[model samples]
Target: MDVLDFDLSDREFWAKPMVERRDAFDRLRARDTPAFFAEPVVDFAPQGPGYYALVKHADILEASRNPEVFSSGSGGATNIIDMPGEFAEYFGSMINMDDPRHARLRRIVSRAFTPKMIKQFEADVNTAAAKIVDDLLDAGPGCDFVAQVAARLPLKIICDMMGIAERDYQFVYDRSNVILGGFDPEYTGGDVSQVVPRLLNAGAELQQLVQDLASYRAEHPTNDLTSSLVNANIDGERLTLQELGSFFILLVVAGNETTRNAISYGLRLLTNNPDQRALWLEDIEGRAPGAVEEIVRLGSPVNFMRRKVTRDFEMNGHLYREEEKVVMFYWAANRDRSVFEDPDRFDITRSPNPHVGFGGPGPHFCLGAHLARREITVMFRELLRRVPGIEGGKPDRLYSSFINGIKRLECTF
Candidate 1:
């Protein structure tokens, strides 16, 4: 792991305007950092405390690996929900917790999302994906792919895993969008007083849904992931309600939002790079594993994963004390030239690509990584096969600093 400069303190460094802060993050997609180190260091501290943004791949990996120093408790992940009150304690998910505790919770749910479980999803995911693409084909020519396809695929996966009815999908999806929309827009839709009440409500509904499914599974077992979660064992104790709820939070945020953004944005990347799309179409192997990797490398759905410094620590030659926060800008880091040969050019086949689009490099890596890839891969495979010459339409960004991707991508088939 290494470090790179991205000081956000200087006003001149950021060309983006404050008014457009809520707009689609054009700043990131519009350009890449120049030359070896990428862009100049950005100073993110505004009107309050100061923290560094790791722009280069080396620095982001450095911050991600040394979780002890760059702890999440100090504000490792940027959030508007945790500014004060009970929101901080209540809204903290696996992503925001440090090693020991994060390890415990993650370990329990980790078994359910393993490679085997994801493989089971392949048939179902492919089926659902084919249906989505089929629907798009019937609709034809002009369609809002984000709403009709990208958003639906991930939501359906989460609901299917939890055994929730299709009717209730909107509640979880809508709340999740607001819950994760800190930088994009003020969460005016949901209650802003705290995240606990909202979380508890969602949890209660999910628990009931799972319990019903558990009863069904007991009498009539299936190959679905829910059966696995219900049967999970942690030190011989079955998962508590709190742990189960946390799993739901991760599923909705990570499984649904992240994958949706990746697919939608991945298409945007392809549309912009017709040559690359042509390569994928023309190639005998057909982009193999590289298409998804390259797309994710460029369209990083998870903008930044934050953590606070626990004890005094040093990064990229800068020193900081405990309680100080730092942001690992995965979006910026994945395009770092030091790591990728041609960072900005979206080649369909870029090997040895070790990008951190899955949140971090080490153990605390995204639990839903396999599910996300399956979701994106299935969608793209069906999309390219069914709809010919399709391209992205007027894209509407959700405008969030965390949990980013396309909210609405108009498309012409």
Candidate 2:
């Protein structure tokens, strides 16, 4: 097979049209081995060894399953470049850590993210989704679907769970954008050089906000997740101020952004596939489970995550050397021909869909996957029920490799 001309690490590549991007990944997936690309140069960190782009489904699944060999902590799983020590202060939650530390944090946070806990928030999720649609209906069409609808539900739910005030919702939203802004100039103020400082500032601001809230929750404990995390459980385990702050940052950034983008993409998908929309509208609740999964499969919002090779290991007929990095392109893997039939088609009932949009099956699978699914399902249910003819115009896509975000999509009924 001929090699693709695009560079996965080139910031410009992410800004390319979706068709071109899809074609590039298709070529990568068709290759015999994972394609290697040089690390993107950034002022924040020195140049490092290039990484293999694991665009195939088998490669991503195998890599995710072997966390010990493909470490999240060696440098950091979130970035292709090793995370600087300063960056870790705010950005280094369990997502960037390995066993023991990662296990401990997951164990503690898992308590709050249990199915029962998420069920407790189900009414809030439903109520919030309904309110958002009500506002969207009042505003009528031509409003930005992202800002008016997609972004609101997740942001409100995450803040409410954290006991954050409504006044600070924008504050949290802006910072989370900056934190995961990737190379987007809109969030970075058109200065690539300033990205690191902007990210650090954003992280610092969010951390401080959470720390202050945590301090209050320490004494005035409530049923909120913040209180549950800050105070001790029956096992007497609690997050340190640093851990609490970083985890909160992760929660708001990852949880808010990923679900928000998924909903935005979900709307876009439904609009593009009206037949699927018709099928879904026929039995809203009955079809929600499958429709939501299919949306996530195609949307693949979180995109790629980087993992470092911890030792010399062979997997799926390829060898990864010690300390080498591998970037698992979830977006590409979700479209791999070997996995899903008619990969690009947006069928609302695509079954056996093992898309790793929420990271692959492993200890590192998304903690809030259940909550995210709930948010997406409830938001769509409310939209389909009230605004069944709602359709999204062309999406103003986020120019970022990490997030498949719709910055502003016009909606019309």
| Candidate 1 residue spans exceeding 4 A from truth | 1-48, 74-85, 88-90, 183-227
Clashes of each: 18, 0
- In the range 1-413, model 2's lDDT, one tens digit per residue, is 66568898898999999999999998888888878899989887899989999999999999999998999998888888987899899989999999988998999888878899999999999999999988998999899999999999999999999999999999999999998888888988998889899999999999999999999989999989899888866466678999999999999988999999999999989999999999999999999999999999899998889998878999999889998999999999999999899999998788888999999989999999999999999999999999999999999999888888889999998
Alpha-carbon lDDT of model 1: 0.67
The weakest ten consecutive residues by lDDT in model 2 span: 229-238
Indicate the residue-level lDDT of 148 in model 2: 98
Candidate 1 C-alpha RMSD relative to the actual structure: 6.1
For 200-315, candidate 1 gives per-residue lDDT tens digits of 45545654555666667656766665666667677875655455555676678778888888888877887888888787777524574788887787778887766667788766
